[model samples]
Target: MRHILVHLDSGERTAVRLALATELATRFGARVTALFAQSDRYGPGIVARRAGPALEEAAAAAKAAAEAACAAAGVACEWWQLLHGERNHVVAETVICARYADLAVFGQYDPAGDAPVPEDLVEQVILNSGRPVLVVPAAGSYATVGRRALVAWNGSREAARALGDSMPFLAGADAVTVLSLRGAVESSVAGRVPPVDIAAHLASHGVTAEVDLVPPNEAGVTNMILNRGADLASDLLVMGAYGNYGFPFGLRGSNTRNILREMTMPVLFAH
Candidate 1:
């Protein structure tokens, strides 16, 4: 993860987001881009009500805030990308851009995800970007240093991308475990390819992973994974997001959908 693209909407500016970004950027010598989308809420009538001056002031404030964060971090900064449109559209566009990004970090509302959303904000982006999306729940400092980790591996592109995105932290992982929870997600043919390919991939990346092929029909797979990570005192969880075909995503299995909605520690996900 040499470069990280940060979503600087209302969510990304939180202290939790800044702390996470700086921690990882400093850890792996990565560049951080605090990207704000200079968007109007919605509707042209709303724009006509108060658009230009209001937008300019908000944008200036956001840019200054992002620059100040970079200055504090002593990391290189690129605050030049301020996209505009509906909030959801800009986020969707950012996810598309994240495909080229090494990693994408951002803060989110709260545990319940009750934060007012325009619509389909997370699933659309995280599912399509093919990049790992890290969610910083609340305002608290987060870093990969001296942290244990739990990884969700299913031998899928989304999962693989997230695992690779986490290599920097995985290398620094005090303890790491890979959990393979296969449910109704795969077709019978998909079972043909063993999930061990993911373990091998992680091994190649120098991640010392302890693989666990949990038994099926095990209720609360997410809880089980979390329990295991908690047993090891892990602070981060890595997983590939699954979405139903509705999100224009290929892997929206129940597990992926459940994990994101019920996130515990910070989760790194790729769609």
Candidate 2:
């Protein structure tokens, strides 16, 4: 990854993702661009301080934090902002910036927190920017990511794209598990590529990967994936961005919304 674009806001988790982006940049010799944005809609979070000096103060603090972190890490860093724009414009600006970077880092939506950005910002950027997005959970201390990765494999084009996009992480991980839903493979088909094939591909790249299968539960595929990620104690989860073009995306088969809502580990998503 040459360039990493991370979203920054007034929320406390800005430090968490900024730390993550700095770590990745140092690891891969990449530059980090901190994009600070705010939503104009009046709702939970910092929307109440939409007008006046308080908002400007918050934005300044966020920018300063990023600058300090990047300076301490000794990585090339740039600052961008969209301080006076509507909610849609904030999301649009973020997406446009992410399109220029190899990977975009975002924080998962916290329904209970006072988020200064749109709740669907991460989803919109991932699905629209044509870039791999790494979403850090809003509540977690991820000092290290991608050491142990759990990849959700469903034999779809989207899944293939995600696997390809996560090569950097996979090649660096100590262990990787290609987790597939039970009965999700076409073992009988002559030209079909199964999870074992995926493992072989990773092996060719010098990444040791194991193939595992799990049955879907009443809670659904997203729950099953999260459960396994917890079981493996993985720091990163690699999956495809399965969703429509708009918000409230009803993803086919697995619900992208549910994954976004319930994901605890940092997930790298590509469409």
Candidate 3:
């Protein structure tokens, strides 16, 4: 919840992307690291001598711009020109793990090749780093973050992490709902520990919340979360973003990116 990492690619640092980062950083007194990862089209080019001095110069200029953005915001920053990797997930993984960023802030992924897949890289950061991600959309602004909120809670480690990290925003909300879906196979030795415990935890923090659970085989848990938020008329949706395992289990979840791409409402996600 403290260190917020921002991608300073394609001139996103000046738009609502950086504005949102400044907003959140100012609120929490957090440091911001604007990472400008070079697009992954250089290795083969260098092999063929296409990546010349011009490309290196451009990389240095990008570094300066990113630094100035952070300086203007009155926070410490680390600017990197990662010139040799995939444009998406590799950079996301590097900063969160290497930089120890508590949270990653990004604008919506408007990829030229595939849109949702790039955005899913953001989801991958949430899942892999076990940290929260605040994604500002292409057309949206930071104005969506305050006032009212919806928290989709399933009583899992992912949900708990999100709930814990989003306290600053949630405490600022109008109404909050800790919604739970999917069945729980619990031990017989203990009573059923419902997701309501989350609501109570939030209540102790002065954030008023309600508890709700959905049945098994419920289609579109993402939709349910949004609908419930709309029912309560919340502005922002806070929830645990579920992702499959990294290697052989890497699967872009339907409930996961479907919620991100289709959600008109903003989602605050943690793994």
Candidate 4:
């Protein structure tokens, strides 16, 4: 939580993203970097040529807004702009920037408009950057995060990795609930590991956590997680993105896709 890299774009959610980033920076006394990617008009098309000026203006506006917000917050901040011709270039540059950041923040996708960041940017960054990403929902105003967290736990490699990556936030949280759905633990095994083990592990790090076993509900796993998150009044949801390399079109685990599509609270994801 020392250095936070935030993806800035010309979208309605940019304010929410910056607010959350600045909030985190203020909490940890960290530096925030607002990154804007301007696409180059190199294609042989009239639309591409016409889009150049609009894109530049949009990027400039976004940068100005971020700077003003960061200034008002009285936090150390930096602005970065990169010229890219394709979506892959933006992703590559973002990944490179994320390498120097302790955490990366992004806004949820909005498919209705020509957003500066790609619709699948968060998924790509999580899979490629090897860093934790905090995705702010596109529709809400979050005043506080990492105060109370709900960890979506399962006996999988991705889940374990996400739990480990969320140590920084969890350690500072006032309460943490580790939720494991039914059938997550193997009963027939001679030595079965339970969600309590995860709580114990967090306790070892001085983050006292409680284990909660969720029964089979009609809402399915994804909805159950979201319902429970709302029930607990959690500001943050910690979970692992379950998908192979090159996701968004590839085969994504059902729970991961559902949460990405319908998350109400900010979610910390790692893969």
Candidate 5:
């Protein structure tokens, strides 16, 4: 990726997100844009009046953290801020900013408290930006990523799109594994096209990958992905952001939601 846009927030996980973004930028010799989005909270006259200053302070702190981190990493970086009067406006601004980026990095939503971006911001950006998103978990520290990568494949349209979008990371990985759960593949096309075709495709792009067909198990697909990811010691997990229709705030399928909730490592998602 040439240009990366990272969502900046004054949350507990902001440092982790900034570290990951700067690492990626340094690795790819890319430019990093740190975006801090401030939103006005709905309240009465007095509460509303005080919200702006607090939000601005949080935004300024987040921007400073990002700037310092990027500078320490010696990466070319720029800062951008969006001041919106509403939550939806924050999401809209993020999506609009992502249009100029090659990849977008965001921290996993923290519902407990102290999150600058909306909880559903990642989902909105994935669906609307037409770009890949790399979500860093709220807990733990990731020192390396895209070194040992795991690709969750199911032969679906979303999975295929994710695979295509992750070519840059795949090509740079030391070892890549493509995992396909049994019964997840469509029967009609199972024999027509093999999973090896995916490896061959990546090979053309200079990515060497090994395919693993996982059998049906009690852990379910989402758990299987996490299990395999841990087993492989994968620093990065690549998967499709599957979503069900009719969701009000976010577009996320069960598996996608589960992974987002429990992931301990960075995940790259495309819808």
Candidate 6:
């Protein structure tokens, strides 16, 4: 909500991440921290030594653009550089930076991009940061966000956390939908507390939400959630990043991974 931390790299979609961060900062009256993190392939070779300056220049350019965008939007901004030294891991460093913010913004993974960021950067941050993360899609332009929202609920602890973390957006949304997947719900408590409980909870926060009790889709839960978001024309999707035990939440869960891979709109995820 406030204290927005956005991850930026030399990737082409860095602007998209900054745009979303600025929009959220303007909406919530928050300060933006643009963290420029890219792996530095430092070594003793001449080519490796030359790559360092290029990376530094790229980081400087990203920082300047982030500051300029924030200034034009009348939002306070801070810049941070997380350098990946020979012994440092980019994912761990990024997660460390994300810990101090209320929400972290990131661009969806682009397999085609030449960005030096680790492929699992976003996933690691979400699992370790203990904060909500909003990921902007890498391919499209989202001029509007958090206006029309879709929340996927399965009554798990992760789902509850996601719902609570997304209260700010839901409370301000023009329309909100809570998609309760029946099969995913615990059978004992399935019929007892339906999506109405969630709707009522949102109502208490001034977020009027309509509930849809959907059965298990033959296709898959992930596809079902994405299809519902597209059908509802939602600008944001809120969901829990379910993970296996002995670790954090389920960023490794297929549902979470699939959704992140095929997401068409921004997704707000919590563990």
Tell me, by TM-score, which candidate is best. Answer: 6
- Tens-place lDDT digits, model 5, residues 1-271: 8999988876777788788889889888898999986456542135443346667778789888988998899998899977543677788988999888999998778678576457788888877888899988887898668899999876667787888888889888999999865343444356766545677788889888898976533246677779888999899999888753212233458788888889978999998
- lDDT-based ranking: 6, 2, 5, 4, 1, 3
**Residue pairs clashing, model 3:** 147-174
Candidate 3 vs 4: which has more TM-score = 4
Which 10-residue window in model 1 sums to the lowest lDDT?
243-252
* lDDT for each candidate structure: 0.65, 0.80, 0.62, 0.77, 0.79, 0.81
- 5 versus 6: better TM-score goes to: 6
Span of ten consecutive residues with least summed lDDT in model 4 = 243-252
Q: Cα lDDT for residue 153, model 5?
A: 77
Q: Looking at candidate 4, what is the lDDT of residue 237? A: 97
Backbone-clash count (model 4): 0
Q: What's the number of clashes in each of the models? A: 5, 1, 1, 0, 0, 3
Query: Tens digit of lDDT per residue, candidate 2, span 1-271?
Result: 8999988888888989999999999999999999887774442245542444655667789889999999999999999877454677788878898999999999998878776677788888988899999999878799879999999876667778888999999999988998864243453453665335677788889999988865433235677778888999999999877733211223562467778888889999988
Worst 10 residues of 5 by lDDT: 243-252
- Model 3 collision count: 1
- Model 6 C-alpha RMSD vs. true structure (Å) is 3.7
Worst 10 residues of 3 by lDDT: 243-252
What TM-score goes with each of the models?
0.78, 0.87, 0.75, 0.86, 0.87, 0.89
- What tens digits encode model 6's per-residue C-alpha lDDT throughout 1-271? 6799988888889988888889889999999999988776453135442337777788889989998999999999999886443324567778899999999999888888778666788888888899999999879998668899999887777888999999989889999999876454455455666444777788889889999977543346677778889899999999989653212223457778888899999999999
Error of 1 at 196 (Å): 4.2
Please give, for residues 56-149, the per-residue lDDT of candidate 1 as tens digits.
Answer: 5556776787778778888888874534555655566667766767887765444443232334555666778766788765544565433778
Q: Which pairs of residues have clashing backbones in candidate 4?
A: none
* CA RMSD per model (angstroms): 4.6, 4.6, 4.9, 4.2, 4.1, 3.7
In the range 65-127, model 4's lDDT, one tens digit per residue, is 999989998888898876643667777887788777889998777667456566666777888
Model 3 alpha-carbon miss at residue 168, Å: 2.6
Off by over 4 Å in 4: 38-51, 113-116, 182-196, 215-219, 243-252
Candidate 5 TM-score, C-alpha based: 0.87
